[model samples]
Target: MCRLIGAVSRHRAPVADLLGDDLDPFIRLACEHKDGWGLAFRQEDGTIGILRGIDRADDSDRLQHALKHQLTDMAVLHIRMASPNLAVTVNNTHPFGDARAAFAHNGEIRPVAALEKLIDPDLLATAAGTTDSERYYLAVRERMNRGVTPGDAITLTAQAITQSSDLVVSLNAMMLTPTGLYAYAQHDPHSEVIGRRGPAYFGLSYRQEEDLVVVASEGWPQPAGRWAALPDGEVAEFPALHP
Candidate 1:
């Protein structure tokens, strides 16, 4: 399994500040996920700035330091634990996207080869690494181009994965669009977690005072308000700006 985090805010804040103490522990946990790590942050011009490395999180102090100091309105972070047959490299890290959209995912794809036929040529061309997460992102982009909304695109992606394999999956993903943040949690048949029968845990918290919204694979450092757990098979959308 892997850990993922994404944030959308009304104001730009240091990525480090948003991550806080959670950053170190999360990075440490990511060490077990040792395949690679990556982060993508939005630029004021609406483009994305991404950094990735094949190094373990513990050795990514430089990368983390840069993100901690840089501030952006939207960001996506991922630490991957490679699945069998997948290559480990910088290009394979999460938070994959094009000029407009970005996404991060945690899970494994079964019979990953089958989905190749379902992806778009353009997306296939953008494949920088051989990882299911990147293919998943491309698949979602293709579906979106076909008029599927972001939420529907996620469900469609899940359905497509089901077609390929029966592996228990734990697809905890985050998508960043121009207008908002969208997140999803779906169980993969091949997940390696212990006691996998319970509900998949994912949470989102918004601090109005800080004008920030945080989406994490697991909740920590309990905050004051009731933390809302995203419903299974449901997508949660947070508007970029408050109405």
Candidate 2:
């Protein structure tokens, strides 16, 4: 119920190139994914600059401003379609971060309140907002805090959550680390997404060009031979762009 975009490369380019200009494609997709919009990019100082709005992407002034002006070698963008029970508020937006990483998720876990109980209570105590997606990120970060690599943390967390929850649909997500971009895509064999959304829309793909690597949800238009799908049930890691 969300769409995510991530870009990282050796050279910082105008955000518009990865997203779009006046013909904003992500905003157009927001017609269906309209809940809130958020953008997080790594700054030159090694900190994050976050711009988010509790409005549809197509309607978000901040997104418009970012596309026009911002530049970064690393960025994450999300246009949300809130799960039925979650509120459409700023705190519940996608793209949450910690000291070392930023994360955004595209799927859901059933009975989120129950799922929260499975995450580390100390970290869960620090959750700024209530949503399955944020809880999932906290769970993974807790593992990373204990020295597990971010890529493995996501895989292990996804495997554990899937074992614990029934009727779970998908677990497609992306994470931004200082040196790499990480992603995983896993789903229930019986979930309705198989018939309703199909593989083309559910698969995560990226192009590691000479200068930058870009990953995004499937519905966006991609150039011929420029994209490759991340294998299901496996984590794909794209190393930082070359200087």
Candidate 3:
């Protein structure tokens, strides 16, 4: 399993500050998730910038510098622990998406070969690394290109995974679009609680007054306001250009 954090603030604020003492704990958790790590954020121009690596996120000097220097209204962070057969490389890091969007996933898909068959060959051709997460992203992109909304595409992807293997998926993922942010989690009965965080492992909290929204794999301990856990199977969308 992996961990992720995302935020969209009304005013530019340092995420490191908001995370507080949680930062060290979260980073420690990420260090155990040694496969890879990534961070993506939107520029003032709305262009997405991403930095990723196969090293432990807590130990990466480059990632640390980028995080300390870069501040944005919107951002996504991911820590990965590669499942068997998945390669560890920068390209395989989470928070993958194009200009119009960004995504981070925390889950594993079983029978990877079978799932690969459902993806469009052209999109797969563009793959920079071999990881189920990347395949899942491409699958969603292909479905969207064929006129499917992100929600519908995700549903289809989930359905495809179910058909390919009996292995259940506990997909905790988020999508950040020009319009808003969306998140979904699919947990199975067999899921185990490995960390100190409660059963509700993922949450998205926002302060409308401040026009700030935050989505994290685990909730922060401070700076409390209106933070809500996104229900399973539902997608939370925020307007890109708010009125």
Candidate 4:
């Protein structure tokens, strides 16, 4: 139901620099995924900064400004298509998080109350939007509160969701933390999106160099030789050097 891209680099730089030409094409996907957009990155003072817009990324000057202005060592971008009933609002737009972490999810999880049952009541109360994606974030955060690593928490969260409802279209997401950018891909292969958008619609891919590593959702032009498809039901972590 969305598209996401993120990267970890050895040095702070604009997203345009980290993602290169792929950024434009990725932005273009906003034409179809035109519900809203968000970007999250580390600030110079060592806090996470998240900027979101209620307009499409391709047409928003805010997105263009952030693309060139928000420099950081780790960053994630999300363009939402929005699920059937979810409203398109700033609170519902992603790259959702607090001071330490930001998360963006690209899939739809049904009967959200099912996942909500898995999150602690106090933690679940922190959610601002009525979105399955926001609930997914809180569920992952609940696991992290118990000291689980981000990547493992993602895996566990997916398992819990499946065991409860098994209605996941895709759990694909990017979580940006101070240490790294975490990308997870988990989805039901039989989901209807495959027949409509091809087999790779829910697939994720990454390209890594010595100092830079990038992960992105498929559907655009990412060279096969440079970007390798991240396996379904797996998490990829790209660490960034601290200043």
Best-fitting candidate, scored by TM-score: 4
TM-score-wise, the better of 2 and 3 is 2
> What is the descending TM-score order?
4, 2, 1, 3
Candidate 1 lDDT, tens digit per residue, 98-183? 65788888776655576666797766887888877888888888999988999889888877777665563666688887767788
Candidate 3, residues 1-243, lDDT tens digits: the string is 688776666655555653434457667876468887887776767777777888888888987777777866667778887876777877778878878777788777766677679887777888777777777777777888899988788778877776785565566777776655667767664554324445655444434435655566663353555455566765666544332
Please report, in order, the local distance difference test score of every candidate based on alpha carbons. 0.72, 0.80, 0.69, 0.88
How many residue pairs clash in each candidate at the backbone level? Answer: 10, 0, 2, 0
lDDT of 2 at 93: 93
User: In the order shown, what is each candidate's alpha-carbon RMSD?
Assistant: 3.1, 2.1, 3.3, 1.1
- On TM-score, the stronger of 3 and 4 is 4
Per-residue error for 150 in candidate 1, Å, reads 2.0
Tens digit of per-residue lDDT, candidate 2, span 1-243: 898888777877767775443236766999999999888777666666777788888887778888768877777888898988889998899888854888888887877766786777888998998888888899899899999998899999888888787657888998877767788887766677767777566678777756767778877777659788778888888766633
**By TM-score, how accurate is candidate 2?**
0.91
Q: Quickly count the clashes in candidate 2.
A: 0
> Distance (Å) between predicted and true CA of 175, model 4?
0.4
CA deviation > 4 Å runs, candidate 3: 13-22, 191-209, 219-227, 241-243
Candidate 2 collision pairs: none
